[model samples]
Target chain A: MVVAEFVSELRARFGIEFKDLSILDEAFTHSSYANEHRELGISDNERLEFLGDAVLELTVSDYLYRKFPNLPEGELTRMRAAIVQTKSFSSFSREAHFDKYIKLGNGEEAAGARQRNTLLEDLFEAFCGALYLDQGRAAVIKFCQQVIFPHIDAGEFRGISDFKTALQENLQQDGNADIHYEEVSITGPGNARQFNIDVYVDDKLLGSGSGKSKKRAEQAAAKAALVGLGVIS
Target chain B: MVVAEFVSELRARFGIEFKDLSILDEAFTHSSYANEHRELGISDNERLEFLGDAVLELTVSDYLYRKFPNLPEGELTRMRAAIVQTKSFSSFSREAHFDKYIKLGNGEEAAGARQRNTLLEDLFEAFCGALYLDQGRAAVIKFCQQVIFPHIDAGEFRGISDFKTALQENLQQDGNADIHYEEVSITGPGNARQFNIDVYVDDKLLGSGSGKSKKRAEQAAAKAALVGLGVIS
Candidate 1:
């Protein structure tokens, strides 16, 4: 679509009337296209992607911080990472129809770069970066509220690593003196070692698991305990 | 320091008189102490660390995005990593007297956990997290301005992997069109192979380097080119 269509669609979709559309132009412009048309002096979206990445992170972090007050740091960290990964952003890009406006070099267009997940992720971030530049932090947050938060609030991105925290909150022990994780065994080669851990309460093993690392093992065990306790299905 | 002393000193130092001093109390309380005195019903600072870490990152990222408008994402990532690492936060904690306020269990205190770099880092983050909760986003940003930004502005965190972007910006060419990096050779075992790279500008070899990976080699070459061009000493 044309720039006017792009501007109108953005307004209709996000209520954002960008002051400087040139930043969005840069956002939609890919490195491949920019390289092919260097004479036009159009810059790529990589820088915007960089800045937009941080913007996205902060937005998501703030959302998670406020939304899930009881979740432990480990769970929040995992959720944030998952929310910002290529899959999530790419999906967000597709939903926002940002995929329709990306400018690609002739070769890249033929090579199917238009439908790539990583590219879409970059576009989403670049778009956010441009939005941040055109508007500010509030604009970005509002945009997320419209575009991203619904998915989050509907319980779409739940159940990654908060199991340990869930188990603790279920048992009313705060990952401290009340809860105990015992290392049952160490197995496998040094480089690829696996740890078996058991989560205990009142000196009874409530859950057990083995994983590639101690932390992972502990988390898995906690998840099992949570399930055994019927805290979550 | 006692809570009252901590309160008075914080106001005197940061011009911040928190409405909820309990937040700061939680920030200063370590898990060890809370674990030992379970009946006190006091929570530790881990959650605050988690939130504060994100807050610190956003604060630093916004600063960098504005301050160094020309820096590439790679350089920004490296610089951000350095600034948020244990050493920097530990030093910040010590300087801000956060180290003096930590409430550790007797064993941890006896084992010198008070001076441990990791502990100090957590304290710094927890402190920021507490400050953020007590104040809000603007307060956190302002707190960073008083605490972190000046050190950043002093040119203390330089000589990171921005050489390629620096070289290109110095040459007034963006990353895509004007600059090129060619792989000269690869040697050593599969896991430990080294790459030799050469960077060119206007068909002239400006710099060359060898590194464990292609990106590193390119960055080294860029640094060399920047030095050869006398852009940065």
Candidate 2:
């Protein structure tokens, strides 16, 4: 694609015009592209990706802090991780149609590198980095607030099996209730040990489950309790 | 110490007074302290620490990006890691006299938790978090630019061996030099293996070293080359 068209697309999509087009150019340029165009003095997106990773983290963190005043640190961390994971970021890039603009070497393009999760994730981050450099933090935050924060608010990215934390947060809403996990049984040989655990909320049994380890069993019990509490489908 | 005295110390040290002293209070309150003071509705610094961690990373990443324009992503990552590491951050906390301000439970205080590196590191992050909340990103950036950036600039936290990357950067300054590492020999049993490697800069034998693995041996050779090139003492 032509550079002007790419720039136009970004402007239309992100609602921000780049003061320096070179930063945007660098953001889309893969290392392979830079290597192939060494005489052109083209730089890769890796450095920008590094910078964008930090920017994305900070923006998401600040949003989470303000939005969830009562949420604990662990839950905040988990939620942030879920939002920024490669899968989530790649999905965002796909929605942004990043593959159409990324500049890859002939070989990488032939290898179908554009659709790769790692490349898409890196491109998304580098784009954010470029946006931050060109337009500043306010622009980047606004972009995230529009593109990323809504998904988080909708609870769309809370991947499988975080029910334990979900249940804890639900229970903690009322007050600090005495939540306990008791190992009810241990069986099987040493090499293949199994544990059955029961979860109690305020001295009342909520759920029970079995697993290979105490932690896993507790998580299973929590999942069961969350289901019983109708917190998840 | 009383909350007013804590607020005064923060103002004297940081040159800015918080609009809401409660955020500052939460920043210094350890989980143990919060646990003991549940009735007072005291909050721990962990959440702030989480926010601060992201703020610190973004500020540092931006600083490094601007300061070292020619640095590759890998080296920038390494430098950022060094600057924000637990040891480096804990040292910053110590220099800031964070121990004097942190509120811990009586039991934790008796157990000498004030001197712990982990606690100090957490307090430093929490302080940044509180500053970001009270002032904004600009203030947090200013705080880090004053406190953390200088240490990074001085190369105080480069820590142990990163000679391979250092050597590579030093050689790549005058354009890309052909740097090669070749395994010269492998000896000893499989479980107790030793390998000798030689590092060549532009086809010149600069240094040679031996270690248990190829990676280690290459690093050792790079370190010797750096020493021979008068780059590090």
Candidate 3:
């Protein structure tokens, strides 16, 4: 009944009713809540998030592939990441006022966890999963294209910029110093490792960065070095 | 000039003109070719692939967000992964005969490189990169929605299930086993790492897999185990 009310509110907001109420509820429910308080028989949104992640990626991939016929996969993937990051999803949750509608455990509520990026992102993921299951791909695609793509497209005219490269060039011109990158450490195993890189000038550590790969870490480190040097905006 | 001709050929095939011919060339140029001969003064597709990966993700993310009005992020990411993974990309490239079109070093060319999954996937990514730079977002979105998503949706509706969970479920059912995942070790200093995981049936290793993450390695192990058990078709 509570779930139905929530769905009704969402439907009223969007002017569309869902065929499956369970999907809507699942989208709003967090795993932590379900884990801590299982007696309510309320399920977590992890599975939905899992499913939603895939659905979201496919939709984004397809849109980019067709929309920017000249764009390659790597650029397309990055653009997708920027739009689908935890922060982005959290913002979407806020825009939709989804956090206000989420069903949280007392602990989560007391902890003021409803506004958390992690939670909001999870909720968004859960929602996608539900959409995929309840309304199918076509419906899901329709919803995403109508609501989300515009925001991303609005930023499509961004100028080509590389913070790290600019930073390096500035440092080189300032003192004729050779920029050096050294790997400090790596976290995670195999393909998931987060590389830590330190940028040094004349044997002095200027900045550090962490990323899923050495090059990215180096770029991040360079980017930080640039910021430290006040070389980039 | 050569790049322009290549773009024309691609345009003929995909029915889209290159907004930036250089982007198309980058998509077609393999890293091996660059590594083998620097005299060409040509950069490889690796960087383009890197950029395309991001672009692809963002494009898909944006599409999913609006298309699935009530959908979340997790499912969207997963679907994107399914579409972008080497297997899927390779399949798409193969179907499109992208391998025959890619410009490879003689060494790679002689090694049956045209049939290589990595090459095909890279080319696909490069193509996306090119698309984003050339025709902008609208064209890419149209093509992707028409081609990729439809196929996945069609396959999905036809009961094309995921391999990861199926393997996990089968493993869990044997003697009520509790599967544990661990990221044993990571290699390299940064974003690059090879993950190793051991899937135990009962504290005894039933399967072992290696990939970029415990999840991927576990999935790979699960798939291998399934193959060994004749569970995956």
Candidate 4:
């Protein structure tokens, strides 16, 4: 349940031993702990958490993109989001038994903050940041792919279907529908141009949407139409 | 044009020729072209585009995340968006002179569609997808590092400063002004709590923010207060 035990478990899980356990210690130390023990001279996990969040997102995103070459952009983005979100990160932390190893102040421990999602997510990010700094991006990438990507890939069967494709396919299948996408208006000038698109199915307005581009607007309109028709959840 | 000529041109710009030019041609072919020329028995670039988009995002996100070890999530997310956006994809397509090689239908060509953002973006995505499938993930990562990562890295020096640090340093130096963050509300169920936090200086509310956790909310509040006080642009 101590920080040392946590590092041993993490090392076993990640297959990388810490050269400086101080990095791991700092990563597990919350600001509350620092606040309570001012003389510790240890920087809290906030900065490391901040760095690790980026590192995690990047590593996971790269891995998924490479492995799943057939997935669309929106699907990839959502998958990356699902993996990096607090909920996912917390699960990873919990699986790592993060609560057992976190170094919290007496006040925080008294407050019963061991299972806090915020704490878990921050700790996971901090851990990732520490791993990256100590081992390198390659190690971080391998750790993430091993620890996180499987959960995301497993969820691919459920809760993560391609909404864009679903919408497009549904529209196309409806009596071989002739979907007319018109750029109704383009507001603003230069990079600010907001394209408004109206999707018509044989002159009946299926949906309307606005985006930076007419194609995106059409895609949005298609997405809205799918929601309107209960084609996508 | 012959596939050899096309590969050489791409090699000049992309610096990597395909072991097979079929992938590149497959990437360049649009659905409209396939529909028009049924004899070619070739599928369009949509599937490849979908795949490529994922590869592009993952590659760019991975590069950005590792390249800048200390950037906050928001800034990193924004940078990812900027790099993988339609505009960026279009630029990439232009750089490769994709306009000259893309196989579009007569109707699309008449509509000046070769220069279209959607078409260019799709072509770029397809190109990536084809490259990934043909050469593998390692090749894609190498291509991304050579083609996309450098551009993203160039923008890194512009907008990735730590807002929280800037805010704290500014407030602390101003006659020892104590900065405080308090959680105003904690809503939702066990795992999905929404936290609202307010940043205060001497009992005066500087900024408030809401996030999935208190730490995030505090960071958001700090970010807002920094911008509000003109501590960061």
Candidate 5:
């Protein structure tokens, strides 16, 4: 799609007209595209991504602080983390159809980089950064309120596993045990491998879980163990 | 000092009157104090510290982004880290005389927690949180611009030690060399112990340094080694 059409579409979708469209354009431009089109003098969005990460963090933090006035610091941190994680941002990007606007090099596009969660997450953050620069903090906050806060209000972040930490803390009160997680098995093909992980508390298997990755499987297993121990519901 | 006197002193010092003095009061109240004075209905500063941390990060990130437009994300992150580290915040707190106003329990006060850098840093962040809540983001930014920006302008954050990482990066080009730091000697009393550390590259003593702690001494030694190798000046 042409730059003008893309910008028009963005304005329509977001319901906010950007003062500096070039900044917004740069936000969607991948490094690969910039590298490929050296004569266009297009800059990548990495810097904007860094700025936007902070902006998003602060916006979410402010919301969380006000929304949960009585919540403790550690729980607040966990909630913020859940909302800001790559998976959550990727989901947001997918929902917003950010992939349709992202500009990439031929090679990257052929490699399906547009569909990649990490890239999508970075693009979303960069878009936020551009929005912040083009508008202001209030605009950024409003954007987050529209796109991000609904998820928080729905308690979408509640299921995020900090079960490992919770389990460790609970066990610590009854004297420290060597609580560890181990990948027990791997199955399926190389590209679609499923990992089975077990949570061990003092050489006893408390629970087991499976996921596409070891970390996820471990977290699932931890959650299971926490549930079994009646530490969490 | 009385709460009203303290509030008046804060107003005099900051030149900004808070609409809600209780929020500011909570910022200065340590958990220890609140735990001991349960009848006073005082809240601790931990939640404020958490909120203030995000505010400070966003403020610094925004400043860095605008100030050094050409800087890469990695460099921006490093610069932000330099400015926002606990040590830097503690310095800011000390310069602002935050230690004088902070409330502590008898036990914590007796143990000299008032002079602790970590506590001071937390207090400074809590103060920022209070200011943010009492005023707004603009007030927090203004406070940071007045107090924190001066340090950035003065290049106080430039010498923050990342020598170990730099040394490792430099060594990585010539294949991996076993680089390690070993504490050679400890001297002085418990409260003021000095550590002597030597940085070794492939079991060869490249440089040595002394400091108040092992980590500091190691960093100093790593810096010396980097200078010796002409990797950094």
Candidate 6:
């Protein structure tokens, strides 16, 4: 797609548009296209993708860290990983109608590379890279808040389960009750330490589990308790 | 160490110090320490590590993306990985005297976790996370510039080899001449395509090599050509 139409479409769709269409155009320029059109000296989107991946990491991480304040580090990492996967980023690309604008080489175009999740993911990251380079992190974050954050907020990337929260809410449904996790046993060495934790609600044991860390064992205990309570199958 | 001493030492060593010593203290608090003092309800550094990892990723990526404009995505990724490794980050932590400030539980301290590479890396990240939270990205970047980027600039993370530039400089020692890479042969199907690329300098075939992608093949060709010219061993 040409720069003018892309800009107009962006304005119409999102009420935001960049003045330097060439940067966005650079984002749209796949490495395949650059390789084919080497004489034109057009910059490909790979470097942008690199920068954008970092931009995406920081933005999404900031969001997750704030939004899921109670979530442990392991769960937060898992959720962030899920959110940044090829599937998730490609979906974000489709939400932005990126396929309509990406300029691919004839071979790649014929190979349907535009529809591929990896390509789409890279395109989305490159788009972020372009936005970041043009306007900076705030602009990229604003763009993310528009197209990416909403989906994440809607639990589209709920691949990682937070069983602890569910269990706590289930037990605290009627009123505020104390819940605690205790390490019942620990085995193995420091590097491969295995911890077994028992979760109790109001001094009543609900479930027990073992894992490589106390946090992981607590999560497993919570999950088992949740299953026992018929909250999850 | 106490907060005041930490702050004073920071200023004395780096000529800069965070006003929020409490936040810095939080960054130093390992989960083991928090676990030991559960009643105190102090925060662990894991969350900060999460945030700081992303911060470090973005800042380092920004530096690398700008500094090595000619590097392809693969090389850039490898270099970034090298820069973000536990060893690299632990060394950065040591450079900032982080080992002296980290707070660990009695068990962990007795176990010598303070000197561990992974823990030191996490401490470095947590420090970045705290700086980002107390100030912002600019502050975090400034800290990185002070403590981390200098080592990277000095090529401390030179694990990833870059042969293309060396060969080009070697060929262009006297004057500028056309250097080109041409696709010579292809094998296998689309999913397993192997490409043979030949590097030519002033109509002379310098080297030929094969790989999964044209860029990889080109790099391989460059490496081979460099080795052939005794530029690299």
Q: Which candidate gets the maximum lDDT versus the true structure?
A: 6
Worst 10 residues of 4 chain B by lDDT: B156-165
Clashing pairs in model 1, backbone N/Cα/C closer than 3 A: none
Listed models, DockQ each: 0.24, 0.33, 0.05, 0.08, 0.25, 0.48
CAPRI grade of model 6:
acceptable
Off by over 4 Å in 4: A19-84, A103-113, A129-146, A149-233, B31-74, B125-233
Give the clashing pairs for model 2. Answer: none
On residues A1-233, what C-alpha lDDT tens digit does candidate 5 reach at each position?
A: 23777767667777767888788888999877865664575678888999999999889989989876655676688899988988999989988778888999887899899999999999999989988998998998887877888998876885544566667767889887899888787788644567798999999998898875554566678889988888777
Off by over 4 Å in 5: A160-233, B1-5, B159-232
Write one digit per residue (lDDT tens) for candidate 4, span B1-233.
Answer: 22567777767866777876776788988766765664565767766775676667656656665665445465666776777778888987888778788998887888889899988988988888888778876787877776676676565433535455556667888578877888787777634557788999888898888876455677788888988888665
Candidate 3, residues A1-233, lDDT tens digits: the string is 24556667667765556787776876777655654454465656765776676667667766755665434334555666777788888887787678887877676688889989988887776787687778776776776765677776765421223445456556667678777788787677542457798988889998999875455676678778877877654
List, residue by residue over B59-172, the lDDT tens digit for candidate 5. Answer: 999988886554557667889998888898998898877888899988889989999999999999999998998898899898888789988766566453456666776788
> Worst 10-residue stretch by lDDT in candidate 2 chain B?
B154-163
Compared with the true structure, all predictions reach lDDT values of: 0.81, 0.82, 0.65, 0.72, 0.81, 0.84
Please state the CAPRI-style docking class of candidate 2.
acceptable
Best by TM-score: 6
Q: What order do you get sorting by lDDT, best first?
A: 6, 2, 1, 5, 4, 3
Q: How accurate is candidate 3 locally (lDDT)?
A: 0.65
Candidate 6's residue-wise lDDT over B1-233, tens digit each? 23577788877976667777778888999888876665676878998999999999999999988877667787888889988989989998998888988888888999999999999999999988988988889887777788878877776664435566667778899799788989888887754678898999999999998876666788889989998888777
Quote each prediction's TM-score: 0.73, 0.74, 0.46, 0.55, 0.69, 0.80
Q: Give the lowest summed-lDDT range of ten residues in model 3 chain B.
A: B155-164
lDDT of 6 at B162: 57
**Number of colliding residue pairs in each model:** 0, 0, 118, 0, 0, 0
lDDT tens digits, residues A1-233, model 4? 13566667767876778777888888888877755554455567765675687667667666766665545455666666767778878888998777788888777788888889988999999898888778877888787777787776565432525434555566777567776777687787643567788877778887888875444566677777777888664
The list of candidate 2 runs beyond 4 A from truth reads: A159-229, B158-229
